[model samples]
Target: MKNSIAILLCVSIFFIQCKEADSNSKKPTVYTVGDSTVKNGQGDGAAGLWGWGDFINQFLDTTKVKVKNHALGGTSSRTYIQKGLWKPVLDSLKKGDYVLLQFGHNDDGPINDDFRARGTIKGIGSESEEIDNMLTGKHEVVHTYGWYLSKIIKEAKSKGAIPVVMSPIPRNKWEGKKVPRNNDSYGLWAKQVAAREHVTFIDLNEQMAQKMETLGEDKIYGNLFYKKDHTHTSAKGAVLAASIITQELKKTNNSLKDFVLENPTIILPKKTNIYLIGDSTVANNGIPEAVGWGVELHKYLDTTRVNIINKARGGRSSRTFYNEKLWQAVYDTLQKGDFVLMQFGHNDGGHIDQPKYRGSIQGISDSTMVVTKNDSIKETVHTYGWYMATFINQAKEKGAIPIVFSHIPRNEWKGNSVERADKTYGLWAKQIAQKNNAAFIDLNDSISVAYEKIGAKKIKQFFPKDHTHTNADGASFNASIVVICLKADKSLGLRDLVLSQKEIDRLSQIALNTSIENKK
Candidate 1:
């Protein structure tokens, strides 16, 4: 964690020292021009939608070339030429600079309407349409979509600037899971214009559509585009589109290829991520005998509504998990309204001052202890309750709902009932949760009831290896109980994500093989 912070600080200091020198000697600029899909609503990510032009810079090595977005919302190919949005960009182009052109989103609107008369003629021919522009109240001659694009390419070349033409990105509309392409109309015309002008042309429409279809429609619809919006994209969608453009640009022999960053980052559509963090009791590594409740929990969740990310590993207590920065990884990705379900305590009973070094102190208090390892590195440790409180509080600071789950009950039994943790780890977890005002799921208590029904003799099958872990059938049973508890808690607002009782019962039985597991 300290190393990451130190690297960021060094980068910040370098930028501060070189700010004036960079301003005095600006690098070559790559200017992008188009409509809303290229640069939406002031290019500030308003309404959770942005354009590819706004994110293209993240894929460029800014030390070699800078980027400028000259695209405007609600402008078509003909209107961009008519409204003088392209003039300033053309005037500023230098000998070695590059200007990208991608228009056509709004070119299909009514040409002579009073609302926004921005449409152009249908084809690439020299056809012209004379209209008394209803919006501007002036005589105007509109050209074809191809003609408007050709003018930009030719004019940009006349000023000694390289021009690259691109087809507009595809909309969220789909036909039987296949993205509908614009190859027949605007794409064909844009390609023809670029060929005639002898400039580089990128078919972003077709290319991006292929990627979208492969990524699946479920991951795209609500995540990339706002619900009910076919056009425009969320910030995540913009990043995906920009990544496609950067990939295509570097493939060309153009000078801009030298400016593209090596191994540019590709961002997928953003969704609400629900992370499950804990020990091996919550993880599955293809071990049939050691399946976890977190693995079987996927059977009951509405995957389309939220992403279930299981970050749980084996043999990690709350203290060791935070100390190793495993919790930091999940904390970095938490967005407002996301959820974090944390479970620990499987390994918290290990030795703290010894070589194993996984245990925390006993109770829920702001207490600390210092220990030295065999390598002579000194570390400060806290109580199990303090670590639990830290997890709950940090999650709240990130605006994520933190759910405290007392670790699942083991197979050990005392006489008639399964062994309980109320006197130990379970009590501490509950106290920390109450103090933090967080939701607590007493897996140790609720799961024990089911175990007690089956009795210790019949439950031995779940723990073939030891008394700690459960088999696949037992994991499914525990997961069903967890779902029921989640649905009853209305404060979490996750009732709609749980499966119906009928489905839950079917999955919990694990094909009716675990009849003895949750039998009435």
Candidate 2:
């Protein structure tokens, strides 16, 4: 009898271990259902657009739970069910699985229209509308948006699956410094349905709107949406939206929340300082009519993320800038990751040994000259390339990134084309950047492109009285040009730190208008 009991106990232990293994191997799935903002274009990021559902999986522990996104573009809560999209998802539901439902973007359209009938009645009441389908030519009974959402919740619960109802994300439209929310409409109805069914409710619209308010209107247009598209999101925007959803999930403390990864804190490096070293075109002299591009550059930058210090002074060439102790002041403050933009050529045309000598020998050669100035101060001047190389090497030694910029164009037009310095300073700057392993921006060429596009008639408005130093409008335009170049160069890593395209355009237009008015 003792031997038989021992065998039975061993068999029982083996069975318990097998059961535990099977339980551990089984993986739960979290399904999502919503409109375009949740999952746009099959969640493939087509046309440079993305949806939040495509990114939410990154925040979850996929090893423990799987994510399935069934959101379709141009879908509403009513059509999602009417087109039988919910049936397959419902059939796949199992006990311990989770279903997240978000809708209401297309629920406000006309119910029975000949052109894409996809709307449902509003509210969560027991209301139904009988209509003859124009496209299908069949008599159908339509329910309210709330009724459809409640159906999804109840069906999920009936199948022993957990239901999570999220109000739709708010549109990009803003009203009086705030992004308008769906609180009175779909948001309220979603909350009511979740309460009635005892399911988890997430006020995504309000939460996202609050975040948008914090980001402000300029950032909302710049950082969130694609070009001229306020409905859909860019890749960065999708990530931000998904992060908000992740936070709400944790707050809800649902069973599925256990499968989510803890939100990782992003530790950014100390703010880098940007120093502008150039001629009068890059200085700040408190002259409204003679504003420099460097003075206006800070407007396009996210100041909270970086600092801009315009150390440029008038009448300073690449040679004179270092000789006059200006470069030393900037170099003294250089920290790791700091940036320096150097542009000089306007005053570098004088004779090397004259009293007003400022020009450095052109090209990347190591040519040097001894100049005796009016103050009888003997100085050893190096070639333009040598000076640039010195600055680049010194900055790199201090763990700073050095960038070279060609001189800005002087509003000179040749047969409807803006003349650029591509043959002179531009070429030398590019050569120096390549030789020293530094970044280079051809500001002359870049601004010339904009000028050609704007035509000489409109472009001349930026240059108020002179061809060299620009007015406020012209300075802002040049600053925007520099920003555009910085954004294109991935090595600079400034694209993610600049303002949005919309914000830039808005500011540029304002500057243009203001300058034109002042000139008139």
Candidate 3:
């Protein structure tokens, strides 16, 4: 009897300890998978496009949830999982986690055996696969794109994670000057599969197409794409994509409905803090009418939900930014989930006359060159590449999302044709961003588009005779461009920062009235 009582007591103690351990454990995470539209990439300049995932961080209650981005550039649903890219996610997934999948940008590759091919015509090929070591260099079997996606869904579900399928956001491409319906494209197919599998779905492509139509083609350009390029999004374009997804989530899932940041919150500040660390164009100049994009950026933001901290200094290159410890001030104060905007190059041209002051080394590539401070002596300066990249990597190390923008345009560009960075510091900035896996905003491309639409006569009002800097009007104009870029790119994490239609109309009216009063 004594032995039986002792054994029973020990079993009860073990059960209680197990329950305690389980209760204290952290919850599983949510992950995303997609292509270039959703993937993070460098913007045209150092200060532009905003990614959707960046803003998604704002919507979730961080205490109980975690989000991971597994999206990449130039990938389709077929290649994303095939290249072992999905392995890391699969390995890390735990029960009760979630996977959000979006694709379709590059899935329409040639039907033949091209290296980039991802999908074939519907019902054109056999469903089964056979081992063929001769045809494939490595793998013995090749599965259809649908098959691969199904595998991901099955695997995720098997691990007790919910798989939510979202169609790719539509490109800015138009037919007859109107945004086309996504009736037959991959966007349509994504819906069909979601329905067939009874998985949750978000039709981002449909939403984006309708959004562009609602905004109008002329109004959509700079806000969506930097140029006539219909495929990729400008910084604003990314934000728009993210907003559609975010709003859709509120509609799609009841559990997440209350968590939307747009809903009034009595609990805490519940705002996302953004810190800017860059050269003149993205930093606050504080000079009237001579504001940089960073300085004028406040007009587009909802201050109640976001805190903007600008630490940009003029005449500072990447090297000077660090040497002066300007970034340290921002870094020391940043909280987790905060964002950092980085732009440089107007001064990083490596001018060596101020030899003691330049940031990057000279004579590395056309992208990075040594500039002599004075014509008399050829004193080598730092490479713009080296100094700029260091700032980006450091910001990432600090656990902040680092968004780099291409340098804004100069008066040197004469026409609607975009002045490619060529061998200049701007080109180097773009290359360095891509190499580092940092989010990039093509400010150069975005600004040029705005300039073209406003026309050279109207542009003179914004840009001074020198063409490099802008007046207050120009600064505000540029700020609008940055906001538009944030809306379309979906990479800078500004999706949750969108203003509703009523809010947008109100701001636009306020701006118009302010302009009219100034004219008077």
Candidate 4:
């Protein structure tokens, strides 16, 4: 009876060990490899740039499997393997692990150049060429792009791991109505390799291109690419690309699809505030008949998403606005994700240090002027550009986006065309925005364009009593024009927060009718 009991205990222990081992083996991981678009610097999304590999985990089921992004920037199919970057990744793969491969952006460089030397022979042919390594000073044989990709697939499969081949994401190059794709080159070869190897394939290039077509060139260029670079993606673009990959993975028959999250919560951003600041042209004149563009701007905005705060005061220049503690109040209430629209220059053209000391020096120079206030207190004033720059830099420090607008044009016309301030304050405001990396709107030029289109005689109705101040109807018209400008500006990200085109048209017509009524 004792011998039988001991045997039964040993059998129970053996079965429990087997079950634990089996459970451990079932826990798989998905590994990613490719170029900069797959993974950029440190993969932390620094400097407004990002890569899809860093963001894919958000849509994955981490409880089921882990995700590891092993991609390196500036690496191609040839160099990635040649430089021993793929060896560690391959060594880490287990029986149930999955690998995702993407390349091609850096594969088109010179084959033996010292700077990069990342190029691979075109096509999936078995052809290879001997070349002297410019960086390592060793003789090496470079294979075709297809050969490099095939090697990865074969090695993964040999290790009992599933391989998913993906075509490189498309660049921000557009051809007419659509973004051009790479279906003829790397994309075609990648798909062929997957089919030849009997592995799952994803057309990431085609998918991203289709998405780009839907987003249009404006959103793609403004929101996706890093600055003027068409290759790398910004944080927003990277998230979008990762989301696309998640969707494609769900369509596959592989076991990895079971690890994708279903109905993941999409986080919406908090509401933003839009603050307007400038001179009389942007202020709320107390009289109902006399108004400013700032007062009427809220009518064209989506109040649910953004609150328009017109903080502009009449007869206040950039210097006075900063010195009088008006800017301090606005700055105190400013918060992250807020927007400041600054338009000054109408009241910044007065003489300095002579009783009415309101004017500031021109240009972006660091020049200063001494002035006496009403209380006989002496103060030093900086250039007009300096004050504007101060406002821009302060807003940026407070995590708010500052947009500079040129002062509206006076009721002055040279022949059939309305004169513009593009040479003076308009030009200076644009310079300040560029220097400070802020968004700029040429309100002076935009209003002038409308006036020129309407002709000098008919456009005079916009100015009721003075050339600098507009009547209520004219304020609404200018405000609608500002809305049009915001819609056209891709970098502002304010298109969705504005009223519909139909509403804008209706408001414009109403303003025109009011103008006629006021004239009568």
Candidate 5:
């Protein structure tokens, strides 16, 4: 007994010393800059759409360094710095910290007097002077896009931060059924600036487009597009994008290169308590071999960080999600920074004459009323707004960041068009998010965009022939969509968990291997 105790104590001390030594080693800090495409939640509602920025987190070891994403919606090179978002970061920059800058989408906005005008001409001294007088609303000077980008590089370098430039990701627009190049546009411009500045450049646009070509349009839709939008990637697509960035980074930064894993990072631990609370799309008891988005979420998250305790019972509205103590059960176990994603509204559509499941009657209302059930208790079905808001509000009350998803889409995708939301659950959810200032994900719009690009025939592979519920591929595909939305939402702080290409491949391979192994 004495010998055993002494041996264990010695081993423990050795590990403790090693951990201390490891902690002392300096890790590099990564700061991000970009427009809405790289920002969080810009493409939330699209089916599988997500910004690559969100998935970048997974590639880094959090123990070594912190990754801060300051990207926001509607920001272009000209606006990001002018809005003062870049100043605080520049001021806080420390030696050896890295700044990864991406822009282009919003930078393409026309140079109008409107707030949405983010576009400026490309090149080093390119300038189009526009002046709006006072009362013309926020009179400001708009610089050329390249000039603004150059400013960011100059400022970041002054602060002793290493600047790495990446081109904006390519949109889904195709020339003769093939994705085009940024050679004549933003991609070329970004490269030109990087060359002039002596900064490292990652051609994300070229890399993504090339990979998409290799994957082929068919595979690209399966791996990338959330619902229909070709420009953005699904969770799977983001993972793939992150992987490409990692591989490119590895060619130079050897330290980060080895951290790549062979799995997509969704490995689950047995008895992990994951609680799924959503509408029919995320609930249990959907069609056989057909599960909700939540059902497949466990496949991407690390099991060590989770417990697969699914509480997603079917046929429950957002009101019922909490009334039945579903959120309460998950809330009880939540630790600091734990996530509770609330998706609903497949069944909360306009109900004819039925008080229950009806949208907010009397104009976006959330007034609470009482009803007595046969059980002799007063029950209430809160307005769709009230139900969703309450769930998010309560989750936040429990110290959890409530991620609000604006309902997964129905299978009404055609070529470049989706069945418009038509003032049902999708609209109501958006209102709930805005009212509470909650982190809302627009899955509906993102998916609709995707539907338009992929068209009706290709979408059939993802949404199922029955037009409801997804297959394993479909479920995994939809789950990727959710990840993409969360990644872009910036509010979710999920950028640190994004996976690299090798890591994604590893994760995908592992998932495939695990499935194969299970089959055997």
Candidate 6:
């Protein structure tokens, strides 16, 4: 009786281990498989060319969802399988994952070449070609592009992973004021395969071709593609392709659409420059956990319309910024149509002329105090308001729009209410802004309101080390709030540079949902 009981116990333990291992392999990941158009050389911007896979993560909430790009530079649908590349991809696919397949660029090449026999039989037909591939040195039966696509889809489905078929992004080929589509060829065939397999199909080719034509030849040549290379895309073109894919996915109602960044960055017609000048809270660079809002704010704006240049430095007050020539660098780059966003006071409240010599006089007065530094250099200091006024006047003289922002609130709280800089630096920032007739963004009060709503206990994760700097999540929250505020004030004339109010509202709701999940 004891020997029989031992055998049964061992069997039960083995089953439990198998179940645990199976559950561990079930984490959802998005795998991209294609040619150079999907992922260029080494998946790096080596020669200014990037694949759509390189920039897809920028449009998705990648911190929550993982994206793996397994595309090679010169492989077709036929070679990808014949060369055993697809086997590893199949091994990685499990239940609750997605595999995006995009090819057709190299599929138009020679079939039995001694160099690269990467071509596939055309169309979604059941045609097949038997050839000893020169590249792989193996006997192979190559089928139509649709046949290869179907094989990948069916195999991914067998692993319980969803397969998403994508038509190749259109090359920079134009047929008199309009780009031609691959409607009768790869695009149609890819769509047919997805329909046959009953999976989602994203028409990336049509979407990208239309966008390219709309951009005009001038913008498309130098800005997007590098003129000579029409087959592969530059970094900008790749990002544009990825953005269009996500936008199409939004319409398709795919589950992966949920991971897409709301109002993802895309190239637009008009262009402007947005210069940001502030302190560590605005320019935090290296600390992996801590991120500055300025660095992430561009994700909220359309890159094609305005380029955000974050010139803010860590541990610099407005007084020191001008003194250190950091502000001058941005001022020189300022153009007539550019916008300047200045946020200070986080480091401006430090001791004046002492340990750091970074703080300024309290108010918006023209008060000046002269002091001698340790290097025997005589330095002239001005009021916090005076420095703010100087920056505003300088920006205006250069035909640039200057928008003043009060420093963001720290994590400190008083009985569930977060600390607001409204009485001090916030008040001065607004006073200077109003005095110069500049647009004012009350970042201190705005961030404090959000923090209070989120509550102190829940946001402890935002401040890992101290009360001043914010982690990536916290910076993203602040940037979203800034976008919301930017949309609210039309006098800033940033309507085209930032997102719409409806988009920010949706983003705010997403943040709330994410917070709720994190708490759970």
Which model scores highest in TM-score? Answer: 2
lDDT of 5 by residue, 452-510 (tens): 66466655655544666655655555666666665565556664343323444354444
What does candidate 2's lDDT look like per residue over 1-520, in tens digits? Answer: 9999999999999999998778655778789998998899977665446788888888888868889998899989978888899999999988988998899889999999887788889899998999999966879899998889988988988988998988888888878898988899999999999999888998988998898899888877546764357788866677777888888888886987797788654322245588899888999868866788998997787664568989999888888888888888888889988888888888886678886688888777988778788899888888888888888898888898899998899889999888877777788888998998999998888889888987887777877668888887799989988998898898886776677778888888888777668667
| Candidate 1 ranges beyond 4 A from true positions | 1-26, 223-227, 266-520
* lDDT digits (tens) for residues 1-520 of candidate 1: 9999999999999998799577635678899999999899898755556898998988998867879999999999899889999999988988778898899889999989999999989878899989899999999988888888888888888988999999889988889989999999999889888888889989999998998898888888546765446789877778878888888988888888888888766553355678899998898757877878898887776554568889888888998999999999989988788889988998999999997799998889888999998999999999999888888999999999999998999998889888999988888888899999999989899989977876777677677668888877778888888888898897887776677677787786662366454443
lDDT of 4 by residue, 312-421 (tens): 99888999999888999999999988999999998787877765678888887899878777898999989889999999999998999899999988889888877888
lDDT of 1 at 245: 80
Ranking by TM-score: 2, 4, 1, 6, 5, 3
What TM-scores do the predictions have?
A: 0.52, 0.60, 0.47, 0.57, 0.49, 0.51
Candidate 6 runs further than 4 Å off: 1-270, 505-520
lDDT of every model, 2 decimals: 0.85, 0.84, 0.67, 0.85, 0.67, 0.84
| Residues 425-515 of candidate 3: C-alpha lDDT, one tens digit per residue | 6667778888888877788778787677656655665555366776566666667766677777776668546544354445544543454
Model 2 misplaced regions, further than 4 Å: 1-164, 174-189, 206-229, 232-275, 298-311, 323-340, 350-358, 371-379, 392-403, 411-423, 434-441, 445-466, 483-510
Question: Which of the numbered candidates is closest to the native, going by highest lDDT?
Answer: 4
Candidate 2 lDDT for residue 441? 90
520 Cα displacement, candidate 2 (Å): 2.2
Worst 10 residues of 5 by lDDT: 266-275
Candidate 1: worst-modelled 10 consecutive residues by lDDT: 511-520
Q: In model 2, which residue pairs have backbone atoms overlapping below 3 Å?
A: 222-500
**Model 6 lDDT per residue over 34-67, tens place:** 9999898997565456799888878887656678
